[model samples]
Target chain A: MRATFMYGAGDVRVEEVPDPTIVQPTDALVRITLACVCGSDLHPYHSMPTGEEGTPMGHEFIGLVEELGSEVTGLKVGDLVISPFAFSDNTCEFCREGFHTACKHGGWYGAGGVGGAQAEMIRVPQASGTLVPIPGDVDEKLLPSLLALSDVYLTGYHAAHMGNVGPGKTVTVIGDGAVGLSAVLASKQMGADKIILMGRHVDRTGLGRRFGATDVVAERGDEGIAKVLELTGGEGSHVVLEAVGHMPAYEQAYGVVRPGGVISRVGVPQYEDAPVGFGSLFGKNVTLNGGPAPVRAYIEAAIPQVLSGEIDPGRVFDSETTLDDVAEAYRLMDSRTALKVLVRP
Target chain B: MRATFMYGAGDVRVEEVPDPTIVQPTDALVRITLACVCGSDLHPYHSMPTGEEGTPMGHEFIGLVEELGSEVTGLKVGDLVISPFAFSDNTCEFCREGFHTACKHGGWYGAGGVGGAQAEMIRVPQASGTLVPIPGDVDEKLLPSLLALSDVYLTGYHAAHMGNVGPGKTVTVIGDGAVGLSAVLASKQMGADKIILMGRHVDRTGLGRRFGATDVVAERGDEGIAKVLELTGGEGSHVVLEAVGHMPAYEQAYGVVRPGGVISRVGVPQYEDAPVGFGSLFGKNVTLNGGPAPVRAYIEAAIPQVLSGEIDPGRVFDSETTLDDVAEAYRLMDSRTALKVLVRP
Candidate 1:
């Protein structure tokens, strides 16, 4: 089997690796049909590694189950499914509370030293909880969007849900990548009255509009907040979805939400210390909520929408590359030329 | 009129001042029937004034409406009412959102150069919105508890509300002062299954138990959190109400709430910059909420309970003195000789 590994920053390679096998009664093995590079991958790709540990390179994927442990229920061999970014038992207290991403025994598929998804096959623990079976056979063309349901779509959905974006809400989405575009779609589905996408790319902005962004603000930071505030009649957006996992975007998200409104950021802060304003946040009574999306919880609803042609998040895949070209995919995504680069094995 | 003024730290004097008169169309003159010392009062009483201005001494009170401004409605002269610590026009966006304390035109009665409730006659702006009329003259015995509803009761209620305390939930209230004791009562009314009061005093602990505290832990900091976890079977409390405004108490509240639980605090942080652990907070998915209690919102329900004798929070008042003994009242409260002190003119 071949898998993608990061030798160091800006160095990604697909090489032969040991095949995955069920090591626990709760584990299942799946043959990967599709995988994609994530924006979060760029964080380490642009920075120094903590130590000399081999790091896996992908998390989001949809594949066919090849084998399952005897303990696994509700799933079997020859089944197509989507695995959420984080694996959990789904029966823990956190799982019951709808924070499966924070499941007590849950761990990230790739970032936690586990094998990455951009491989010929992958091992999924707690299979009954981590994998959601597809209703029917999914084609290769539907792979990008289905793979998206694994993380990006769920993250975007979480952003909208946490922000309480619904009917009559004016939502603002910061970051014009796959997650932001998915957020625009999710916000519309949640019945947001208006959605303004903040991005510099015309193509991405166009896709945002198609995905239900009623307006677009090309500026960043203070300028972007100014435009959003202006659009909202000086009140600012009622809900803000921050998909960019950086300090500037987080600050902008905080700045543009109306007092008493909500700011939901799915952006994974790169730094250990994320600076939050206690004074301003407390004074305005804003609700800040977001983290790893409970993708498994959202897959049931989002998959139906995608299969019904009600939403086509596949448009977010601006480019596609083979597993051998996984390194190029990383470069294209890091350069911001591609919102998301679908990887085919 | 005579008023209590804090000239500097440890310097409080009862001095003669002109009687307050209506200064704005929304202002009403209130003759203080009962004014009490607050925990926040100690901030200026023991430290330099925040601004270079005359320091008025109190904000909590039950008063008689002596005069109404031309624009005042829903209030009449001779009406006995409880005035919230902060005044706000109920029509503003913030007020409409049930955050009257953050209203655009809101004014703090005692802190920002406005006359304090400790004075014989105080001018209250936004009178109709800030004053809740009490039913026909209450007995003198119940005046202290009713006066507490003006600020302490509502503030404590806000904490419990922020924590989402309700049926089948367990709540831990930090601090055993008047506000913390009131929080126990509020949690019980909210139907919280269990209430734990953490403090180091026997007198207030007894009062808290009487006010519906299910358990008492006289430990401090980590030990207090450890006891709370022990009480909740190592899962931590479902809600934590931080009634004491300090870093240690805030940290303890954070430590004692289970993941996905809420931490509602009404203690105003005296420091300009308070650092919080975004790492632990974000990971736990805790809902941190709080601010000044929207007393006007709760007074409608709270006042009736106070009037009916279903709950007597007035037992928290261990000392009652005349206006001439205001200095001594402060002394007793500062020395922890009284849970709360009520001053009469």
Candidate 2:
């Protein structure tokens, strides 16, 4: 099997790895049909240390069930399915509480001996609870959108959900990355009255506008905060979806959130300390939420939205490649040449 | 009229000051009948820098509307009222959203030239929006509980409300002070299935139990975390009300919160920075919320509860003093000799 691996900083490679077999009665083997590079993967790509044994790279993927686990009752061989980035039993206390990413029996795809999804074939543990099966053969064109449900779209949805985005609320999405754009779309679907996209790239912001951003702020820092404040009549947005996990993004989130509004972050935070004292959240009485998307908890409701043509979250994938060119997929996103890249095996 | 002011850390004095009169068209001169030293007041009592002109000392108070400004239509002379700690127009976007502390025209009482509530006569700005009036003041026995709605009890309610404490949810209240005890009472009123008090003081935790703490842990740091984990089947509490605003209290909040639970802080945060990165909140997917309690928004509902004997939130006031002994009130609360002190003028 060919899997994507990170050798060191800015280096990703498609290398031969042994094929995975169902080791547990609850596990199933999946043949990857579609996988993609994630913004999070760049976290490691930009700074991961060199190693003899490279790190497995991707977490998002859609596939055909190649072999079913004997204990898996909800899925069978040949079914097209989507696997949320984190695999879970989906029956634990956290899972039942709609926090599947925190499920006691769950773990991320690239952790706990689980292979990355950006491979030719991967073994999925807790298959019944982790994989969402599509009834028949999925339309070839629908693969990208279905692949999004596995992580990106749902990750975006989690931001809106966590931020309490709802009817008549104004939302500011800070980032034009795939996840940020998906959040714009998700906010629109959630019936947000207005969405402001804070990103510099006209091209990406254009896509953001199509994703339902009512406005876009090209400036950064105090200027960006000024523009967002202006747009919201100086009160700021009801919710700020912080999709760029940098400190500046977090700062902007607090800078422009209306007092008592929410700042929901899906971007993996690159820093440990943030101001939550009197000068920041405490002074304004704002709420801060968001973490790894409980996409597993959200995927079911999102499936029909994608199927019904209500949202085309796959529009985030601006570039495409084959498994052999997975390294370039990483490069395209890393170099800002692509919003997201779709890789087919 | 005499007023209480802090000359420096631990230096509280009651000095003759000009009697307050209606200064703004929306102001009312409150003949403060009851005022109390709050847990928040201790923040300044401990380390407030010395100054030629000392800072005003109290915020919570109940009084008779001695005089009303021309524009103050909702309150009149001789009317009894309880003023929330912060004065606000209470009709702005934030106030309408039930976050009165962030009202567009709102400001804290001890700020913006408003005299401290611990005085003979204090002028309240935005009177209609800031003071909740009781129809007739008759019972002396219920005065303390009514005084509580001004801040402490409602502040506690804000913690529970912000943390989303509801039926069948387990809650951990992290403080043994007036506000934390109020949180226990508030959590009980909100129907939390189990309430844990993480405080060492026997007398305080005893009050917390009366207020509805099902379990009390005297340990701090890791031992407290272990005990709370054991109490909740190792999943921690669904809601953690952080009534102690120090870093250790904040740390315990994250340490004992269930995955995806809420950590609501109503305490005046003493520090400026905390961890929100992968190591603390992000990995657990926990939600952090709360600021100064929007007591203005909550007082209306609480009035009925106190009036009907549904709750005795006033039990938090363990000490009482007179206007001449205002300095002693601060001393008692500062020295931990009182959970809260009621000062009458």
Candidate 3:
């Protein structure tokens, strides 16, 4: 099977790899139909050290079941299904609470001897609890949005959900990537009264506004903070969605958040230490939350929106590629030439 | 009039000062009947530099409205009132959201030319919005509980409220101070099923247990974390109420919090930065929140409970001092000889 692999920083490759098998009774083999490059991939792309056999890449994907282990239930061969970025048994205490990302018996794809989703066939452990089979015949038009439910779209939803974004809220979304744009959409769906999208890219911010951003601020750092605050009537935003994991984005979150507001960082933090004392979060009485999306939790509710055409989350995919050209997909996302690059295997 | 002032580290004095009077239309003169030395006072007590006049030394107090400003409605002269640690107009967005600490026109009593509550009389700004009047003649026995609502008790309630403590949840409180014990009491009131009080002092932890702690762990650092994890069946507490502002207290919070849990820090954080990366809060998807208690918000809901004898939060005060003996109150708290010191002016 052909798969994506990273040998080191600035090195992404599509190479032939052995097909995955159902090694555990609760596992099943999945043939990925759709996958994508993520902004998080850029983190490793910028500095991952060279390693033996390289590393499997990609965690988001929609697929068809190719083979099922004897103990696997609620799934059959050839069934179209969606797999969350992280696989969980769905019954663990954490998973039961909708925090599947931190499930006691769950793990992410592409690590710990598991193959990444950007592959021809991948073995899925805890298959019964991990796979959400699409009902009836799947519509081709909903593919992108359904695929999005596996990660990106839900990641954005997680940011808004954790930030307590809802009616009468003034939200500020930092970053113009697919996840950030998705947050703008989610905030709209959640009935936020106003949303300020912050980005330097005019093209992406335009899409952000189209997706429900009431305002756009093409500024960075101090100016961006000032603009957001000014737009929010000098009190700053009720909820600040930090979709860019960089320190600057985090800083902007704190800077533009109203006292008693929330800062939800869905972007994986590239740095560890942050100010939480009087000079930052504590004095303002702000809440800092959001993490790995718990993508599994949002998938069920999002599927109907995609299937019914209530939302078009797949709009984030600005470019497409095949497994054979997966490297180009990474390149497009890395160079910011594409918002998100879809991979069809 | 006499007032308490801190000239420098380890120095406190009760000296003559001009009587307080309303300077603004929103100001009212309050005659201090009850005040207390708070744990936070220790922060400045240990490091505040010597100055010509010195800093006024208290915020919490139950008092009588000696004189009302022309604009101060909802309050009358001779009305018994409770003042939150911070004063706010209670009309700004932040105050409307119950975050009086961050009110746009609000300020603390001991700062900005305002005399502290540890005085014969103190001028309160935003009187109509700052003072919560007792409905009737206050019973002498309920005095302590009413005073507790001014800062300590509500501070604990803020931690529990922000942490989302509720039925069927496990809580871990990391401090044995008045605020921490108040947290234990508050957690129980919120219906937490398992309350783990983590403190080394037997006397204080004993009080915590009496308040509501179902379990007590005296271990500190890794040992404390291990004990808490063991008590939670290895998943850690659902809510970790951090009432000690030091880094170690913060570390213990993360160490003993279950994935997707909340760490509420009412403790005045002494450090400027902390680990917020995958190794700490982010990876586990833990929510970090809490700040100076919006004592004004909870006073209303808590008043009935105190009046009805449902809770006796005032039990936290272990020593008594008069205006002339205020310096000894500071010394007792500084040496940890008193859990909290009550002051009668």
Candidate 4:
């Protein structure tokens, strides 16, 4: 089975690996149908410490259940399914609260010795809880969008949900990456009156506009904040979504969120410390809430919209490739040549 | 007029100062009926950068309007009122959203040229917005409790409100100070099934119990977290209220909050930065929301309970003194000899 692996920084390869088998009573073997390179993947592709052995890559995929363990319930062999980026027991207190990412027995794909999603076949633990079954055979055209539900779309939805983006809200979305564009779609779906996308790129901002961004600010840093404030009648937006995980993005979010507003981040943060001090947030009465998206929890709520064609988040995939060309997918995404790259297995 | 002034670290004096008078059309001269030394005041009392000019102290008070400026509305001379720690215009976008502390035209007492509450008279700016009028003459016995609403009680309520403490939830309140004790009362009022008060002082914890702390964890830091986790059946509390505004208290809060739970802090955070990295909160899906309490917003909702004797938050005042002995009040509170001190003019 061909799988994607990262040997070191800037080095991605597709190599033949052994097919995954169910090792636990709660596990299932899933045959990958579609996988993609994510914005987060670029973190390691740009600069992750190299090891003697290559690390498995990719955490998002839509697949078919090739085999199910005896304990796996609510699923059958050959059923199309969406696997959340992380595997959870779903019965834990966190999972019950729709925070599957924090499930007591959960772990992320490609971490803790788990099989990666960019592969021919992968073993999924806690299958009953981690896998959301897709009804009927999925159309080839809808694969990329459905596969998005495995992570990015749900993550963007989580950002909007946490930021409290709703009817009549002025929402500012930072980053023009796939997740940011998805957040634009989500803010629109949530009924935000005005959606502002802050990005310097022309192409991505154009797509952001198509995804429901009412305005776009090409300025960065202080200028971006000034632009957002100007667009919001000098009061700043009611909600700010941070889809870029860095100090600058978060600082911009903190600056552009109106007093008493919220800033939600779905981007995996790169910094360790945030200055949530008296000078930054206290006087503003802002609420900061967002971590990993509860992708499993949002799958059901988001799937109908995708299936009904209310939104087409798959447009984020600007390029497509075969399993053997997984390295090209990573290269294209790494260099910003592709907004997102879909890989067929 | 006599007012409490901090000449240096640990040096408090009730000195003769010019009586406050209206300086703005929106100002009102308030004759304080009761003023209390706050836990936050101790921050500067312990050590503040001293100069030739003494710093006026005090931010909590219930008073009678002695004089109303020409522009003052909704308030009349001789009317008793509760003043939030900070004064706001109450018409700004932030105040409209119930965040008066963050009002664009507001500023904290004793900072930014605002009059201190411990004085015989205070010139309150934005009087119509800053003062919540007492319907009738407040009894002398009820003065302390009503004054509690000015800061501590409202602050505790803000913590509980931000933490989303409600029916059937387990609540853990850090600190045994007036605010923490108030949080216990607030949590009970909000219908929390179990309220845990984490404090070391038996006397304060006794007051916490009287205020409705179902459990008391006397341990601090890691042990305190362990005790809270143990009390919640190893799942941690659903809501952790941080009433202590220091690093350890925040760390303990982040430690004991259940996954997907909230940690609401109204402690006037002392630290400049907090580690909100993946290692701290990202994987847990926790939410952090809190700031200076919008006391003006909560006064209406909370005063009814205090007036009806449903809760006695003023019981936190374990000592009383005249304005002349303001230094003694600070001394007693500084050495932990008093839980709280009520000052009368």
Candidate 5:
């Protein structure tokens, strides 16, 4: 089977890798139907530490189950399904509490030298808990949007949910990446009255507007904060969705959130320390939430919307490539030439 | 008038100070009827910066309105009122959002050379917004508890509220100081079924139990976390109230909170930076909320509970002294000889 692997910084290649097989009674073998280059994949693609062994690379995918182990239940061979970025036994305490990312028996794809989603075949542990079955045949046009439920859309939904974004509230989404754009759509779906997208890219911000961003701030840092505050009548937004996980993005979030509001962050943070002491967020009574999205928890609820043609998160996939062009897909996404690149197996 | 002033580290004195007068039309002078040494005061009392000038030191007080400027409405001379730790116009955007501590026109007591609450009289700015009038006060025994509503009780309530404590949830409160003890009580008021108090001091933890701690974990750091996890059947508490503001307290909070739970911190943090990146909380989807209590927002709702004789947070005040003995009060609290010291002028 062919899989994408990063040889080193700024290096990506699609090469033959051993096919995955069900190794545990709870495992299921999935043949990838669709996969994508995620923004987070760029983290290591940009500067993964040198000398690390090349490994299968991808966490989001929609596939058809090819085989299942004895213990797997409610799912059978040839079923169409979506897998969250991480696999979890949904019955764990954390999973039951809606924090499937922290499931006791769960782990991230490709972690610990395991095969990942960017492969033709991958083993999904805890299949019954990790796989969300799609009933009947799914439309080819709906593939990208449904595939988004695996990570980006669910991640964006987590941000809005954590931020408590709801009717009559003003939401400011920072970052113009696919996740940020998805957050704009999710905020709109959550009934936010005013959705503000903070991004400098004209093309991305234009999509943001189409995704229901009522306003756009094309500045970064202090300037962006000023514009958001100005747009919010000098009070700042009631909920600030932090889709970019870096020091600057977090600083802007803290700067633009109204006192007593929440800043929901879903970006895989790049920095180690955040100044969350008395001088920063404490005095304002703001709530800081968001981490890895409990995508499995949201996938079920989000699917109906996509199926009903209520939302088209697939718009984020501006470019499409095949398994052989996985390397090019990464390059295009890294350079921002494409918002998101859909990869077909 | 006499005021408790910190002359240097470990040096506290009650000295003569000029009487307060209304400097603005919005100001109101209050004669301090009750004041208590706060856990936060120990921050400077233990090791104040060298070469810093002496400053009046107290933030919690219930008093009689001694005088009111012409523009001070809804309050009059001789009225009993409780002043929150910070003074705010209570009409600013932040204040309107229930974050009075961040009010544009507000500032903390004893800050910037201003008068503090541990004095015979205090000149409250934005009196209309800063003072909460008590309809009628007769019993002197209830003074300590009512005074607590100004800061400690309100702060505790804020932590519980921010943590989203409710019926059937398990709550773990860090710190056994007055505020922490108050949090145990607050958690109970919020209907937490199990309240665990994490503190090392027998005397303090004893008070915590009286307040509403169903269990006590007499350890700190990792050991404390382990104990809490064990208590909750390895699932961790649903709500972890951070009543201590130091790094270890926060670490314990993050360690003991269940995935998807909240860590509400009310401690005036001693550290500048917290690791809020993926390694810290994002993976667990834990929510970090609470800062300065926004006491003004909570005082109204909490006061009714205290006034109704349903909760006696004043039990935290184990010792009593007069204004002349203010220095002694600090000594006892600093040595942990007193959980809390009530002072009268």
Candidate 6:
């Protein structure tokens, strides 16, 4: 089967790899229908290898269950489902608390030598908990948005929830990519009174505004925070969503939140030693909460909105290509030419 | 008026200073009935000018309102009150949200050019917010413990509250000073089932046990955390109270809290930067909250316990001396000769 593999940094290729089969009794073999590049993928794409071996890329996907292991329950062959970026048993104490990402037995696909979503068929561990049957028949046209619920949209929503974004909250979103844009939408859904989207592009900024960004700051670094502070009456936003993982964006998120506010970083930190400055964070009495989003937790509610056409997150897919063009898709994403690239398998 | 002043690292003296008078419309002159040495006072007492102007000391006190400014309301002369360490207006939005320490016009006492509380008469700012009226007269002998609620006890309670210490939760307290001991008491009040007091003193540890610490670990640093983790089946405590303000204690707080748990630090970090390695905090999704305690918020509920003898934090004051013996008191506390020293002016 043709699958995406990283030969090296900036060297993602669609190569002939063996098709995945259900090896564990609790696993399900899923045939990928749609997959999109995640912001987290860019980490390995630019930096040194994250794993000991060459890795498969991509974790966000919507797919059909091609086969199910004997131990798998609540799922059947030929069913369309959404798999959370991280696999969990969904029955653990942590998962019971809606923190599936922190499940005792939870693990990540496309990471730790496991094959990822950018494949013809992938074996999903703990399938009963990993796969959420799609609400209804999902058209290929809406696959990108549904695929988004598997990771980015839910992550944005999780960031909003963690930051306590709600009515009358003034939120500053630091990052204009799909996750950041999704946060704008989620903040609106959660009734944030004002949202300042910080970005460097006009097209994405416009999309951010359309998705409920009450204001946009095109400046970078301190200037962006200055604009956010200005918009929030100099006290800074009540909640700041850090959707871009880096020192600068993280620092900006810290700078723009009001005292006793929150800075929720959904952007996966690329470095092992991410310095979440406690001194600055402590002085402001701010709360920092972030990790892999509990995508399944939000999917049950988010999928309905996407299915009802209430939200059109698919508009984020500015480029679309076939599995054969997966290499160029990776290049386009690496070169920042695409907001999001959808790949059809 | 007589005031306790630190002449140098080891030199304390009772000396006459300018009598405090109401400087702001919101200020009141309080005749301090009781004042206690705080752990924070040790910081400057150990580092102040060797032979320069001696630093005035003390920030925690219970006093009788001897004079009121023209604008003061809700408090009157002759009323006994508990003065929170922080002077805040208490009517701001932040105060309404129960974070009076972050009130818009809030100011801390004793460290930033503010005169010390170890004086016969001290000026109280934002009197309406900073001073809580004592419900009824209590025995003068109990003043020491009641005075503790003005700072340390309230601070420990705040730490426990911020860390979400509650029923069935396991809590690890990182410091066994007055505040840490007080936290053991507070955690019990909050319904925490398993409380571990990590201290090195037999006397303080005994007091901690009486105050509801179910376990005690005398080990320090990494060894202390290892003991805590071992006791908790390697998952670490559900809530960690960092009551010692130092790099090592802060690191221990981070090292011992379980994933998705909380670490509350009420100990004032004297360093310009709170040296925290966020790699662990971020990965575990720990909620860190601490600062100056908002005692005004808790005094109303805590006074009854103090008066009824249900909780005697005053027992922490192992020694009492005349203001003339200020030097001896400083030395005793600095050398850990006393858990707390109460001085009579």
| Steric clash pairs (candidate 3) | none
What is the TM-score (0 to 1) of chain A in model 3? Answer: 0.99
1 against 4, candidate with superior lDDT: 4
| Whole-model lDDT values for every prediction | 0.83, 0.91, 0.92, 0.89, 0.90, 0.83
- The complex in candidate 5 yields a DockQ of 0.79
Per-residue lDDT of model 5, residues A1-345, tens digit only: 998888788878888877887789999999999999899999999887765678678999999999999999999899999999999999987888889988999998987656878879889999999999988767889989999999998899999999999998999999999999999999999899999999999999999999999999999989889999999999888999999998999999999988889999999889978989766788677899999998999998878888989999989999989989889899899889999999998
* lDDT score at residue A113, model 6, on the 0-100 scale: 55
Per-residue CA lDDT of model 2 for B1-345, tens digit only, reads: 999988888889989988987778999898988999988888888888988888887898998888888888877788889889999998888999998888888897777788898888898999989998886555888889999999999999999999999998999999999999999999999999999999988999999999999999999999999999999999999999999999999999999999999999998899999999988999889899899888999988888888889999989988999988988888888778888899988
Which pairs of residues clash in candidate 2, taking residues 3 or more apart in a chain or in different chains?
none
Order of the predicted models by lDDT, top scorer first:
3, 2, 5, 4, 1, 6
True contacts kept of 1: 0.26
lDDT tens readout by residue for model 2, A60-172: 99988999877998887888889999999999999999999898888888777989988899999999999998765556777799999998989999999999999989999
Greater-DockQ candidate between 1 and 3: 3
TM-score of chain B of 5: 0.97
Interface RMSD score of each model: 3.1, 0.7, 0.6, 1.1, 1.2, 3.8
The superposed Cα distance between candidate 2 and the true structure at residue B240, in angstroms, equals 0.2
lDDT for position B309 in model 2: 92
Model 4 ranges off by over 4 Å: none
The CA lDDT at A231 in model 1 is 95
lDDT of 4 by residue, A118-194 (tens): 88888999999999998876677888889989888889999999888899899999999999999999999999999
Report the error of model 4 at residue B37, Å. Answer: 0.9
TM-score of each: 0.94, 0.99, 0.99, 0.98, 0.96, 0.95
Stretches > 4 Å off in candidate 6: A49-53, A271-279, B49-51, B111-113, B270-278
Q: Candidate 3: global Cα-lDDT?
A: 0.92
Provide the clashing-pair count of each candidate structure.
Answer: 0, 0, 0, 0, 0, 0
Candidate 2: segments with Cα more than 4 A from true spot: none
Model 3 regions lying over 4 Å from their true place: none
